[model samples]
Target: MDKFDKKILDILQHDCTLAVSEVAAQVGLSTTPCWRRIQAMEKNGIIRGRVALADPEKLNVGLTVFVMIKTNQHNPQWLNDFGQIADEFPEIIEFYRMSGEVDYLLRVVVSDMKAYDSFYKKLIDKANFADISSSFAMEEMKYTTALPVNYL
Candidate 1:
């Protein structure tokens, strides 16, 4: 990717709603080349899907919980089953298999303590776990979807 491509990516990362013409102007490129670069990026999978960022408070799910899980079962069948279980819940937005002390981690959002309690009960009933710990986020200090393009 060249300077023009990087500039286009940076601008789009900030506001994807901008029209192609507007982005072209900002990146100092004419309409055709700018649009072509964006198309190329999308085809190559550098540019993922565009989405509107929603307000969690307005949606009535402001509480964020980081769940750290440790499990004794390390077989592929157990991992696949756990993955399916995680997919069953809309509250689980992010899930990951880790390399450290924790076997897995999940980021969940819910309305309040009552909602979380219900979710926890269902989660425990679905599978067996060695340990599960949760930490509530008191405040979001910093959050952004934009990624740096300098490395490219």
Candidate 2:
């Protein structure tokens, strides 16, 4: 991508709600060219999607838990089943298969201890686990959805 494209991306990543004209103005481009660049980016999958950020505290899901999971069954069938199980729970916002001591990791958000207890029971019932440990996030020091565009 060129400098104009990088600039456009940087601006859009910060606030996508701006009109194409406004973005064009910030990037020193006319409406047509700026709009075309955005459309091209979307078509090429450079711009994946746009979304509104929500406040977890306002949503009553302030508790963030990092769950590290280990399982004896590491076969494909077990992983497929676990994926389905993970899909069933909305509390699991992010899930990943890891390469270290932990087999898998999940970032879960919930209301409180009572809610987490209910989720934990449901999870254990749905899957087989050799070990599962959790660490609660006391504070979110830094968080951002924006990605650096300097490499572009």
Candidate 3:
């Protein structure tokens, strides 16, 4: 991708709802070329998908819990079953398999401690964990979905 392509991506990542003409205006391209570039990016999987970012506080789910999980089992079957268990909990928005001390990490958000306790019980019932630790996020100083595009 060239400079114009990168500039287009930089703009889109911030506000994808902008019209192709608006994007063209910002990125110094005409409507047709800009629209074509966006379409091409989508087809090539560079622009994966767009989503609405929600406000957790307004949604009545203000608490964020970071759950660190360690497990003895490394077999594919165990991991698959664990994945299914994770899928069952929508509150657990982000799940990642990790290296070093923790086998997996989950980011969970809920109404309060009581709700989190309920989620915890449900999780323990479904999977086996060598260890699990949680840290509450008291405040979110900065949170953003935008990835750094200058590196590209």
Candidate 4:
């Protein structure tokens, strides 16, 4: 991608709601070319998808829990089952397979300790885990959807 494209991406990353004209003005481009660049990025999967970042407190989901899951199973079938279990819970905003002591990790958002306990029960009921360690986040210093434009 060119410098203009990088500028366009950086501008869009901050505020996706900006009009093409607004973005074009910021990046020193005409509307059509700016629009074309965005479209090309979308088609190429550089721009994955746009979303509104919701406030956890506003949604009654004030607690952020990082669940470190250890599992003995390492087969495709087990992985598929784990994927299904993860997909079943909307509270699980992020799920990942990892290397090292933790086999998997999940970022779970919930209303309270009680809610998390209920979620834990459901999770254990659905699948098997060798160890499930949960750590509640005290504060979120930085949470952002924007990736660094410098990487491109």
Candidate 5:
């Protein structure tokens, strides 16, 4: 990717609904070249997919908690089991295998503390781990689903 490609990515990251002509205008490219650049980015996996951002509050999801888990077993089977359990839980919006004291980190969303409690109990019941620590965000100062384009 060149400067024009990077610019295209930056604009799309902010709003994918922009018209081809609008993107072309911003990137100082004609319609055909701009469309080709976008298509190339998508073909090469740079632009993975487009999605609509939902309002968590409007959806009645008022609480967000990060759960850090340290597992007792590091076997492949146990890891697979843990991943399967996480996939089954709709409340677990994001799960990651980390490189630190904690073996995994999970981002869980719920309606309230009561809902979080229920989700926590279900999580512990599903898997046996060495330790599980959680930190709740009282308020989100700033949140963005966009990726940083400075590296480009």
Candidate 6:
């Protein structure tokens, strides 16, 4: 990946819906070369996949909470079971295995406090977590799905 590839990645990260020609124009490349570069990136797994970002507020999902979880067991079977349970729960937007006092962290989204309470109950019932703590986001000052590409 060179400068042009990096530029392509930056543009795509902002909006993957841009046409190859549009991307080419923005990145100062002709259509064929630009398309080829994108194809190469996709083939090499540098460009994984594109997705749409939805407005949680507009969708009636106004509450966001970060749940820190400490599991009783760290065995492979327990991890697999937890993973499966998390996958089945739609309210869990993101789940990560972290390095800290907590074993896992989950980004949960729900309609309201009541909905979050129900989700929390469901979570505790579904998994064998030794400890669980939640931190609610009163306001989101800044949120972006895009990663910084300047490092590239």
Tally clashing residue pairs in candidate 4: 0
Q: How many backbone clashes does every candidate have?
A: 0, 0, 0, 0, 0, 0
TM-score of each: 0.97, 0.95, 0.97, 0.97, 0.94, 0.96
Comparing 3 and 5 on lDDT, the stronger one = 3
RMSD of each: 0.8, 1.1, 0.8, 0.8, 1.1, 1.0
For all candidates in order, the CA lDDT equals: 0.97, 0.97, 0.94, 0.93, 0.93, 0.92
Q: In angstroms, how far off is 32's CA in candidate 5? A: 1.7
TM-score winner between candidates 5 and 6: 6
Among residues 3 or more apart in sequence or in different chains, the pairs in candidate 5 whose N, CA or C atoms overlap within 3 Å are none
Runs of candidate 5 exceeding 4 Å displacement: none
lDDT of 6 by residue, 1-152 (tens): 78999999989999999999999999999999999999999999988999998999999998999999997798999999999999999999999999979999999999999999999898889888899999999999999877777776
Model 4 lDDT at residue 21: 98
Q: What is the lDDT of residue 116 in candidate 5?
A: 92
Give me candidate 2's TM-score against the actual structure.
0.95
Across 1-152, the per-residue lDDT of candidate 2 in tens digits comes to: 89999999999999999999999999999999999999999999999999999999999999999999999998999999999999999999999999999999999999999999999999999999999999999999998889999977
Q: Which 10 residues in a row give candidate 2 its minimum summed lDDT?
A: 143-152
Q: Kindly list the per-residue Cα lDDT of model 1 for residues 60-126, writing each as its tens digit.
A: 9999999999999999999999999999999999999999999999999999999999999999999
Work out candidate 5's RMSD over C-alphas: 1.1
- Which one wins by lDDT: 1 or 3? 1
Can you write out model 4's per-residue Cα lDDT over 7-85, one digit (the tens) per residue?
9888878899999999999988999999999999999999998877788899999999999999889899999999998
